[model samples]
Target: MKLNVKKFENQLLQRLRDLKISNKKVLLAVSTGVDSMVLLSGMLKLSKVLDVEINVAYIDHQLREQSKEETKFIKEFCFARNIPLYVYRWEKEEHPVQSIEAAAREVRYNFFEKVLKENNIEYLVTAHHGDDQAETFLMKLIRGGNIQQLQAIQSVRIFREDYQIVRPMLIFNKKEIYDYAKQLGIKYYEDETNKSDDYQRNRLRHHIIPVLKAENPEFLKHVLEYTQQLTNNLQAIQEVADVKLNKISKEETLDYNKFVKESPLWQRILLERYLEVKGLEIKETQVQQILAMLNDEKKPQAKFDLNEKFEFYHEYLKIGIRIKSTTSLNLEENFELKLNQWHNLEEGKKIGLFKINEIELMPGDETLVVEDNENWVIRHRQPGDSLKMSFGNQKIKKVFIDKKIPSEQRNKSWLITKNKNEVYWILETKKTDLSLAPQNAKIHYILVFRKK
Candidate 1:
């Protein structure tokens, strides 16, 4: 079913008007596809009436030399229309980070974010139609995530700390986009991969979803309606879950005894809610751990090594987190050991000379000790930084992996350094680690966490 240009144009204009996106500079992440090209031209047609200035960009993924053709296509189209085009180039070696598609997408968005800082760009416009939304929902569903993961992408998202993202064509179906592009004589380059199951999203679009559509032609409409309704209730769900979970968590700590006693729905909700606060994803396995800990006879403990950043600790009736550094200490950056330090350390920092002094505290009490440790300093991670634990020598990196720390929090963790070896107090990062006696004296120095 082909759509007339005026109809699609009207819909686009209505979206822009509803969003109230400022009529300043809008950056289009153009891929030279039919969807994006059509969106670009529609924005162009609406610009005069809406008072919006537009900039079009084609991100050359450089996955293949053929991708360069997309750059050429978008460049030519923009040149013919007197629209400025920004092209970002990426070589294979430039992104030795992830798979080509993932790497390319990251680099491209990074390009846009960089451009945002330089130019007065107000919003980023994209051409993800109704079909794309359905595809995304299906993907999240298959992955077995809860409501937060399955929430539909917003048509107008506030992405930046200050700026925004606008998707004006979100309500339009792909058929409408295709027809409008054709009727407008818009030229676009179709990457053959889009039609193949080369990517998971494409696989769903090409293989899985078509069968479902054959069964229910109105699947997208129904799903969209359901999502609209869900959005209305999402915040309420979050609020109830937040309040109930906070109640059971008991001072931001999960008491498994109480957690297990709640209804299954509340338990799951609490688990999901707490994990979000702790910066951990509540995967099915992790959820199982929560259940097991709740049912245990004594205080239970479980740790997840989430990307070498932070450790998820759910034991002894509470959930605490620990972040371990992956490399040897970097002295340039200020690294402070929270539980290991001296009396009124002035600044909350680690690694400074202190005259040997005697301090006394119980095994479970907080003690601030100051001593002259020649090799100790607060620093960033370095290569070959090892900790000699009771389990023999192990790389802090390996410890991080075995511990299931989240990746984003790793570098933020401070280290206690002594000579070349790291003084890994409290199992790299633990709620509590044993502090050594001051200057080889008999007095045991223990800094307990402040009791709430």
Candidate 2:
């Protein structure tokens, strides 16, 4: 087939202009594959016409034996064309045992980031075409997610604060890229692993995508058109969602009572935007978990672990995402219990010992009522301390073990005690018989714990 060389070059040149990457120092992430080779060749041609500064970055992952040959070819190609090249060889010893593909990608991007920063490049150009976008869209669709996940492979996005990553080749399909490279006599190496069905993408590429294309000749074009449309729609939705979120959200906290009034779709959009602003990826399960926690009428307060470092929590009318604190609270150390005052603890935790005549409690407030003991002290678990339960005196250690409280958390959990070594309340985890105030008791105390 005869290739429309000028048409392809013009389209790429226009894309560069549209992304505003023309006449700027841009680094090309090349892999000596057809798609990237076409990108490199096209950019070299455009550099002369548009006065764009071209630099090449190639990560020799060293996973395949052909990497050595590819590296030599790229070196000679760059030298002959008078283009600057940056190459890094990822040693086999450094490769991970599992998820090697993802790990290699991380390493490759890290290297590209280093090169871009050291060389002061403004844009990192990549060769992700329309076919890749279609595959990614289908993959995420099968996996299930919100619209943001369905919309794949952005043509231009922020790589960091100032630098941007641009994919001009996204305007073309995979076959167009290969044909362009062939017509221009651009030397490229094919990755054999791309044909293997061991990877999901490869499986799609070999079996599913071809079948889809066979059914509809313009599948890639339609996919690209839909992707762009989705991108535009998301921008509009995000603008509206941002406004809605700002009204109900304060810092990391959201007024969930007000948030629940919005439509379910809007709620999802708002939550997705909220996490995006906080730089957290929202998984489908996480979104459902958070929504269930927020909407559950029975459970006034609940928490879901988003990851090891972060958590989503709903308390009364408020819900929010926060970083999980690693602070260890010493239960053995006692603090002077001040009456009628909220004592601040580590990680925005608060405890109060208030003298009250009537029992009044709010949702999410863990309270324990006991006979007024002027000598009450606030502390965590201690040796030989036991909770006075209905059946018998249960060891504080045994209570924690029975409750299945994690050891790390058992040490950090707070407890209210009086008369030394008598555990009155195990905070939110449990309430002992000692928590009940005597019927004729003149004085009563309510120990409350809250997370701000």
Candidate 3:
């Protein structure tokens, strides 16, 4: 069934009017692409009938030569209607060639945003139709998404917030939309990409969906309707969850017993809310895993490392988050590394109460190394240090080369220091060491970066 203009216009006008955006200037995204061209035509019709004007903007991604011609046609079409046209030619230079499609889309949208900002355009309208919505739903399902991500495209998106993205034809199917465009004698540019089966969307449209629809003719329509209903239910569930969440939830932690008592649906909602607040989230399986620990004897360790920065722990039926574990020499600022003050290291717990005796070139078992006499900080080798090699007291750096340890690793290495100087040198001066020193009389220190 064809979509009546009055009905379509009424639906759009109602939404825009409710939001007080009916007569505002809209920057129509016209790629001479089918959907966009339909939108441009619809808006042009609307301008005459509804007393408004729309500025047409075409973005040439410049990936193909056809885009130049497509953009030119769109400009000409707009000119015929006396509609103001803006053409932005984007190149690999403007939008780097990496992930061409994604780059192109980003640049195109950014171009629209820029135009909207500069020209004081109120709304950025696009020609995303029902097929687009269906394809998006399919794409999201194929890739992955939670309930929210499944509804990939919103009917009305907020571009600037003040300038809304109003999709007038979201409810119309592709066949009807194309028929509408043809019936109105609106000329549109066709891109070969749309028909190519190489792209996932086209493959789904050309191959997967057709076969599926043959099995169940009304599958797309049913799914679209189901998705719409799902969206409504999702919104309602979210509202109820929000109310319960405010009443029952606590920051950094939750009452495990109380969370367990809630319905499974509510539990899912609370978990989502909790994860979102903590900047952390997990799969349904992980959520179930967390839930399963509620009745377990051993305090099960259920942890979620979010963005690898914050880590959440669910132990003893308690939920809490903390910073990630990093394995790096938490070095001092600039070139002021204090080797003497390294006694407080948790890593060196065994070498408790160790102190620096002397750090110097000495005739030792291994030649040179950094060991804790008490609990001194003997980190990795430094670049500029000169030490006696294990073999014949040669330059310790020569041993490093023989050891095949990278120069970078040697910068913060665990080199043995003795009394801040050799025992003989220290004995001669009787001077207390200022930095990394010999802790033990005889010990071989190898780079045990991590015990594991």
Q: Write the per-residue lDDT of candidate 2 for residues 1-452, one digit (tens) a residue.
A: 67799999999999889988767888999999999998898888888777889999999899889999999999999999899999998999999899998999899888988998999888999999988988998998888867777678888888767678898888798888888887878889999999889889888988999999999989988888888899899899889988898899866699878899999888888888888888888678888878877778887667889889998877666788878878755546887677787889878878888887543566888777766747777787777878878888888887876775655567777777776566777876887764378888888778778876
| Residue 250 C-alpha lDDT in model 2 | 66
Give the C-alpha miss distance for residue 428 in model 2, angstroms.
Answer: 18
List the global CA lDDT of all models. 0.66, 0.83, 0.61
- Alpha-carbon runs more than 4 Å astray in model 3: 1-21, 48-53, 79-87, 94-98, 119-122, 158-163, 211-220, 248-261, 277-282, 290-297, 300-302, 315-452
Candidate 3, residues 1-452, lDDT tens digits: the string is 66575776566556445545456777888777668877666666567545566887777777776876787787677777788888888865766646778988887888888888889887887877777777888898988747777866776666745567877667666776677777777777677778888789998888777687779867666767777788788779778877876666566577566776788777777777777656565776766765565445464445655455876565534555678667666533122124332233234321112122343222321221335433233443444444533322334465545554433344444443343322211111111223233555465332112211
Candidate 1, residue 311: lDDT: 61
Q: Show where candidate 1 strays beyond 4 Å.
A: 22-24, 80-82, 95-98, 158-162, 243-264, 295-297, 300-307, 314-317, 324-452
Q: After superposition, how far is residue 151 of candidate 2 from its true place, in Å?
A: 1.5
Query: Each model's number of backbone clashes?
Result: 20, 0, 33
| CA displacement after TM-score superposition, residue 204 of candidate 1 (Å) | 2.9
Runs of candidate 2 exceeding 4 Å displacement: 325-452
Please provide, for model 1 over 3-103, each residue's C-alpha lDDT reduced to its tens digit, 9 standing for 90 to 100: 66777688788878998844678888898888888888888888988898888767776765578777777777788888878888776678676576776
Error (Å) of candidate 2 at residue 300 is: 2.9
Find the candidate with the highest lDDT and give its number: 2
Estimate the TM-score of every prediction.
0.66, 0.74, 0.62
TM-score of 2: 0.74
